[model samples]
Target: MEISNMDPPTRAGAVETTPLLEGDGKRSVQAVDVVPMKFRDMPVAAESIRKAFEDDPLMEYFDAADTAPFPVSRRKLIDMVDWMGAMHQERMLTVEGGMSLMKYGPPGNQTNLPSVAFLRDSLGRLRPEECAKRWKEFGAKARELVSAAFGEKVADMMEIQVLATDPDAQGRGYASALVKYVLRQGDADGRDVWLLTTSAYGFYEHFGFVTVRSGKVGEDNPAWDGEPITLRIMHRTARASLAQASSEPKSPVMYTV
Candidate 1:
């Protein structure tokens, strides 16, 4: 779906804003507007996504100090997110407190290897070979699970690549707005929406996504401690409207990971 021209529902020619409240049960700040992300918004949007996932399990695995050569710093992750926004700006939507990047069609070559190699060269300490190997392994595993769960229909779906709300903005509904905006586009285009998430399973459930497969990653790394992070693949079939989907009960068809 082409979402560049699509605007979230708004009021009075201005993007609708959600109110920010204080700890004392009173309004503290003005509502922030949700809009399509612009080139100028890239840095802020990237930072927001990075901050939102700073403590995420998957990120922690990649950032582990003992994971020699493959470990990535926060700065590198931020740069990667910034690059992603640059590559797919048309599908990136942002508000002051949040951002979401969605992609339509098959999950083909989503990243430019040459660009990433350039980035690795520029960033000197980023061990390109090891990082590439780790990413390749992870990608292959993820694709294997997804293909097993969805079969050939995986190519027809829309993907929620990244959805994040700044930590302070958690209760303000920015994430929900971002998610719903993409979901509306998916529904309009007759595409099911799917995503891989290490957390927020319950959060997405409210929007009609149900966990179709679940598996542990990072278990192969001997340097990793504790239980391997569990990744869940969530899917939401196309529906006429978000309201209609929420009003009806759903029984998800599950696939073992």
Candidate 2:
């Protein structure tokens, strides 16, 4: 069977920020605010992605070339999230912000923590090179679609973060819509979405991504430089999935509230 597009639905024009109240009924750290990452948030997103990289000794290479010990680049940060959202329908939002402490501030040493700060690795992983390669492959189309959709300097690359909905919103398919949205963006841009993960391979595979052996990836990638870790890669064509999504009856919506 040929695969098709599974673009998610986007309800709002931009990220919305809400306030998270504490048990004492005071404002929490995240302030219950939600916003799709903007140009201004690039720095904060970069810092956030870096801290996430720091938590994983295994993922350190994601920060830079094997020779470089620090971050690969700030662009890598935006690219990571952009691609992540694109690949995951910007689904990383629920866990995006809270990752800082786990990534940077302290080693499991947080003060006045909010519930949003889940685990550090919540957004998942990516090597800078992989991000760039996919972006280059998908850039031209992405520039056209994303530019038209958002009206800005949408790079051949992108970054994304999406929040799952609440129980009150259960069965509404928010998560599914977000997933579809990213896939649609990829389709419009003519790029295949790529991502790495320790688990949840099944979820993505259903979308038509085949699991690639980590060995195959390591050997294929020079960045592994002959020392790739135990990792798995999954990817699907952005355009095809969107085509499929549009042609078929939508799947049953699954909510996370």
Candidate 3:
């Protein structure tokens, strides 16, 4: 993906941006707000993710499946995000007018599932029987890969499941801010953060995440053609200390407020 022009930084406590200021006629300046959102924000979050992941490898792979018409890939992704948000509440963050990030802790941390009504609505008019076979095939392969990568202690780690920005808001700094917040949360809690990405491997590396393992995703599956797509699993180790000394203040990574 191509990188777009970024918005300029602003004062920390301001929620609204200053009047539009043009720069070189190529870009403009505006303040963006990044905050943790509540459950009521899922629909907007889901839409943002669906739009961002429209061209994503994983979503495209699913869309190419034989049962694609019966079960829409984007809809499934939106529902998955909703279910994950329900499982991991406060960990989900939304950037005002820009992007959203959803993460999940260990299985033990998930106290409940999304409601049946919500799930039904997410699936829309599609029948479960039509998609069951493909779902099982995808789930089994993904689970096996994850299990092989993390082993028995997977329950103790954090997973960055979703990080998406509205296409219209891509030029802004929303992605960077959301990433900083989640990484700090993981660091403060002293838990390793793991994620799987087919693209954006370099983007994550800028913030200290490193690849742990990589493998083919669509190999031997009818959903794909020719060579299989590569999927990378990355991990970031937890920091022993979350703070810096006043005398040795680090360069600002992102706006906190």
Report the number of the highest-lDDT candidate. Answer: 1
lDDT of 1 at 51: 65
Winner of 1 and 3 under lDDT: 1
Give one digit per residue, the lDDT tens place, for model 2 in 1-257: 00111121111111111223357943333322333433444454445444433433234333334332233563344334443333232233322333221110011121112222122123222324564442232323223333333243222323232222332332333333444555666677675554333233444444454443332123345554544433333445455555574454323222110
Clashes of each: 0, 36, 0
A best-first ranking of the candidates according to their lDDT comes to 1, 3, 2
Q: Report, for every candidate in turn, its global Cα lDDT versus the true structure.
A: 0.57, 0.34, 0.52
Give the lowest summed-lDDT range of ten residues in model 2: 101-110
lDDT of 3 by residue, 1-257 (tens): 00011000000001111112246532243455666666566666656666777676655655555354534454745455454544455555677732454444433442224453355445543534423443444445545555666776566676666577767666575665665666776777777777666666756665566666666656766645745656666777777543331123223221110
Regions more than 4 Å wrong, model 2? 1-37, 61-178, 186-192, 195-203, 216-228, 237-257
lDDT of 1 by residue, 1-257 (tens): 22221111100011112323477844343444657666666666555655666777766655554244433353535355444533464555677723432222233422334554455445534434544454445555566667666777766677776566656556676766667777887889888988777767766776788889877777786755756877677899999987798787766555667
Best by TM-score: 1
Task: State candidate 2's TM-score.
Answer: 0.31
